[model samples]
Target chain A: MIWVNTIVQGILLGGLYALFAAGLSLVFGIMRLVNLAHGDLIVLGAYLILLLVTLLGLSPFVAVLVAAPAMFALGWALQRYMLNRVLGDDILPPLLVTFGLSIVLQNALLEGFSADSQRLPTAGLASASIELGAINVGVLPLMTLVTAVLVIVVLNQIFYRTRLGRAFRATSDDAVTASLMGIKPANIFAVATGIAMIIVTIAALYLGTRANFDPSVGPARLIYAFEAVIIGGLGSLWGTLLGGIIIGLAQTLGAAINPEWQILSGHIAFLLVLLVRPRGLFPRAVD
Target chain B: MTLINASSHRVEIATSASRLAAIAGFVIVVLLFAAPAFVSRRLLQDLFFILTMLGLAQCWNLLAGYGGLVSIGQQAFVGIGAYALFGTSILLGVNPVPAILIGGVVAALLAIPTAFFAFRLAGAYFAIGTWVIAEIVRLLVAQWKMLGGGTGTSLPNSIRREFWFTETIQDLFGVRAAASRDILAYWLALILVLSVIGGIYWLLRSRRGLALSAVRDNLQAARSVGVDALRMRWFVFISAAFGTGMIGALIYMQKARISPDAAFSVQDWTAYVIFIVVIGGIGTIEGPIIGVLVFFILQALLADFGSWYLMILGVIGIAVMLFAPRGLWGLFSDRTGIQLFPIRRRLVRPMISNDKREG
Candidate 1:
């Protein structure tokens, strides 16, 4: 029964991991850019929510509603103005630029908030749990799982069912061809990054409410997100969700054996996955 | 009448301008070696840090500049080397100096598996794969209780007193044991930096160096030309690991302490090195040297500002990447064409003598 409960909890934790990884997957699927600052941007979104929660006395969820658009705008501007110039055949420019951006964001956050950990006041939501047969689950984790699914569903809809989605796919396939078809690759990229930032804002809501975060925590989160994305395979959103579950299960089971092995177990699982399937479990045929 | 022309050949590695700079560089290195004689202990220690950082930046540049492997997880080698030093000396009671070499071998061995995993991923994924591997190594090391586990351990007094040069250094400098230890560490650091820089320059001048740049410029093009890109990459990766491992060991030895976090700190070891290399010039040999000086100057000027100092560094790094991607040295070299450590081969034939004379 305990093992069953642990597995169930791990599944819920996977939902949050998926949320952390969704935007990264989205951006990579389109531009082929692996944003080193993705995790830091998520942290920045969390800080935005924190600001609204404290200064305006808004609930974390409501704070996300306000912060999402702001982040979207910032993302669009960042892509159109700065990142676009560095995107091309050479990979180092984008990678190094994002790395520098990551450092800049983390240090700026630290300078603003100090190194002290901060969390959103969850109003008892964090500890609230319900009995499901033989196991108990936290409300926050369950909500996080639902949100992750809904976000993926909506993203899939946008990717496959809309004109903007066509532009995104067309540009991703061949930007020059897309341009010939009157699709501006730059604008498409800006929109894609903006959407990714919105998802980042959603992830931030759960992250801030569920856990304490300091400026330096970005890189660790980035590792988890990267592991999840790689495990699922690049360009596959559903695979990212599964990757998150696998990591979450490994971490939980390892913790069940010994607390010290929890993080190591997740990393080992990631390595094992890489060794077995270098291209990931569900690699996109295009890239 | 028959006329014969006599030919003269010059195989000079440097131009006259760079030849002058080389002389100056040699003089500076000699002065640095004699630093213990007149410099304060604190200045010596600071120089040790700078030299170590300079070596690390060079190794990273070799991998990224010529080899095209932009790794963000070099701390893996650093941590492994540091712990290997501790393990070899404390557990096996090996001599500390030789143990540092052993640490290099251990790190290189570990890097083999790391390359196997990371090489599977292309472009950006490869970068993150290295980081994940580094974190895994750090976590695994933290669990090893023999080396003080999570808390960390300091070098034993016995081992500290037993360094071969400690006695000699103390006798020669006529200083306290602590001061003498610092002097020895400083000299070791100086040697390490010189060898790392010289070795890199020599490698760049070799034929294999041209192959490395070919591979970096275009994998398929190089492969089509029978360059064997993978072999070159493997060579660069393994050599980088070896050098980085030795650097890590020497660094921990200087501090006389080994902790997982300190040894594997992405901020201290990787990020700063990346910043230095990028802001100096990525592919050029002189870039990291120029980068480190800029780094030290910034650090000296703003280190007191705490987080703000870091923010300033972050800001400068981003600004440089966005505006001056070639870095300060790259910009300067582009305009002046003066290379202190010139590697590119140039054919210089003093205006083929137009006048023919019979001797």
Candidate 2:
């Protein structure tokens, strides 16, 4: 019964990991960019939401509504002015630039927010749990999983069901040919990044509410997201969810045996998955 | 002008600037070596920092700038190497000096498995994969309770007192044990920097160097031309790990303390090194030397500002990548084709013209 409970909790935790990775997957799928600053940007969104909640006395839920659009604009401007300029044949510039951005964002957040950990002011929702058969699950965690599924569903709709989705697919397939057909790869990239940032804002809401976060934790978050993306396959959204669950399960099971091995177990599980399926369990793109 | 043989074309690797640099380099190295004799211990320590960083930057340059391996998890090697040094010295009762070598070996051995996993991913994914491996290593090292587990441990006082060359330096310089250790560490750093720089230069000027750069530029093209791209990657990867591990061990040995956090710090070990390489120039021998000096100056000036200093460094690094993609040295070299350590081979045509006969 306890083991079953742990497994349930693990699957719930996987929802947050999947949320962390969904934005990363979207950006990578369209642009083939592994934003080193993706995790930092998520933290930045959390900080933004935290600011709105504190300054205006709005609920964390409402604060995200306000922060999401602002984050989208920031992402659009970032991609347009910075990332697009460095995206070409050579991979070094984009990688280094984002790496620098990661450091800069982390430091800026530290300078502004101090080194102390901060959490979203969750009123009772954080502690509220409901009985589900044999296991009790936190309301926030359950909500997080639902939100992740919804985000993926909406993103998939935008990716496949819209005219803009056609442009995205065309540009991703061949930028030159897409350009010949009057699609602006640059604008598409910017919009994609902006949408990714909105997803980041959503992830931030759960991240801030669920646990305490400091500036330094961004990199660890990045590793977790990266592992999920890799384990799920390069461009597969559903694979990312499964990847997140595997990692979450590994962590919980490892912690059950020995608390110190929690994080290590997740990394080892990632390596083991890679050993068995180097292309990930559900690779979408051939690359 | 005298007539020369028409078929006397020869390949040239040396330029006037490089020849001049060679002489200047000798003088500078000799001065650096003699500095401990008269220089204050404080200055020696600073120099030590610059030299070790320069060494690490060069190792990274070889991996990323030349081999196109763009690893962001180099701290893996550094941390593992440092821990290996600590584990051997403390547990196996080995001397710290030779223990440093063992650290390099261990780190290189570890790279085989790291590469096995990381190579599965391409380009940007490879960078993240390597970082995951580094994190894994850090967590595992932290679990070694014998090494003080998470809190970390310090080298024994006896180890420091009996460290190689420390007694010799203490007697010769008539300095305190601490100052003698500083001097010895500084000398080791000096030697490491020299060898790293010299070895990289030598490798760059060799046939294999051509292949390595070929692999970096276009892997498929290089393979088409019969260059063993995979072999080159493995060779560069393992060599870099070995050098980085040695530097890591040496650094911790000098500090005489080891914590998994400090040893595996990406900001200190990897981020700073990456910035130095990016700011100096990525693909040239002159880049890291120039970069290390610039980085030292910047750190000296802005280090008091704490996180702000890092923000500034980050901003500068981004600006450099965007505006001066080749780095400060690359920008300068572009304006004036002066290569102080020239690696590009040129075909020097015969002085006498036989154009009519050839035509």
State which candidate has the highest DockQ.
2
**TM-score, cand. 1:** 0.97
Q: Which stretches of candidate 2 lie over 4 Å from their true place?
A: B1-6, B353-359
Proportion of native contacts kept per candidate: 0.79, 0.97
Candidate 1 C-alpha error for residue B80, in Å: 0.8
lDDT of 1 by residue, B272-319 (tens): 999999989989888999999899999999988887777777777777
Q: Considering every candidate listed, which one attains the maximal lDDT?
A: 2
Candidate 1 chain B weakest lDDT stretch, 10 residues:
B350-359
lDDT of 1 by residue, A1-287 (tens): 99999999888888988999999999999999899999999999999999999999999989999999999999999999989989998888899889989988998898888899999898899999999998999999999999999999999999999999999999989999999999999999999999999999999888898999989888877888989999999999999999988988899999999999998998999999999998889999366
Off by over 4 Å in 1: B1-13, B356-359
Q: Per-residue lDDT for A1-287 in model 2, tens only?
A: 99998898888888999999998999899888889999999999999999999999999999999999999999999999999999987889999999999999999999999999999999989999999887898999999999988998998898899999999889888899999999999999999999999999999999999999989888888889989999999888989988888888899989999999999999999999999999999998766
Pairs clashing within candidate 2: none
| TM-scores of all candidate predictions against the true structure | 0.97, 0.98
Q: Model 2 residue B184 lDDT?
A: 86
- Where does model 2 sit among the CAPRI classes? high
| Candidate with maximal TM-score | 2
